[model samples]
Target: MSNLKQELKENIIELLNLEEFSVEDINDNDALFGDGLGLDSIDALELMVMLDKDYGIKLTDPKEGKEIFQSIAVLAEYIEKNRTK
Candidate 1:
């Protein structure tokens, strides 16, 4: 689980081009949007692509991403349960 969280953090930094934020900057429970990482709609789209392309997890509904992408912990848990790759 920890490994998955770390991987998720790394992937988020790389995929979203969060050059200002290192892995250490991201907290497992920190929000990924709004006041936390401040990721907007475009970043969400990129993450959806990342999920499909990197984890073989297809999310047909964007609204679903709101909960799944809430934080690294949540995302990692969701991926652990659903990842095909």
Candidate 2:
């Protein structure tokens, strides 16, 4: 895996407190929300905070976040496109 993919996986696991998943358990295209990982709205909010904290991207609108955070693949693409740092 490239550094970006690895970093994203590690960050997601750490930021979301996914204690049951090691780095390898998190596939690059894993569904991070809804039925896949069982993450809920609150987890999405936490992940938004993580984006702001770690990537310098602030998602002020929760609705906007819904489109951006559909899954790990989508989230990574959004971050890659929007992250300031």
Candidate 3:
């Protein structure tokens, strides 16, 4: 699901207003928080919204969100398996 991963990268940059980053700047295995991409709790919330709105996947647990948001690769796999849209 390379296309899905790419779309996710694009959407994240746009959604978070991360103007300093580009799609090519984010690797599939890079962490989305703390150090790799340097995202914070606010960005995570936005991503959760994007997941629900774009993939029809609603997350209810913060712990689960932590696991899914580990990296673009992991997120893409989770979406491929669980996405309803």
RMSD list, candidates in order: 0.7, 1.7, 0.5
Give the candidates in order of lDDT, highest first.
3, 1, 2
What lDDT score goes with residue 13 in model 3? 93
By lDDT, the best candidate is: 3
Q: RMSD to the native, candidate 3?
A: 0.5
- State the lDDT of candidate 3 residue by residue for 1-85, as single tens digits: 9999999999999999999999999999999998899999988899999999999999999999999999999999999999999
TM-score of each: 0.96, 0.85, 0.98
State each model's CA lDDT, in order.
0.94, 0.81, 0.97
Clashing pairs in 1: none
- lDDT by residue for model 1 over 1-85, one digit each (tens)? 9999998899889988899999999999999999999999999999999999999999999789999999999999999999999
**Model 2 TM-score on a 0 to 1 scale:** 0.85
lDDT tens per residue, model 2, 56-80: 9999998899888776677778888
Q: Which is the winner by TM-score between candidate 1 and candidate 2?
A: 1
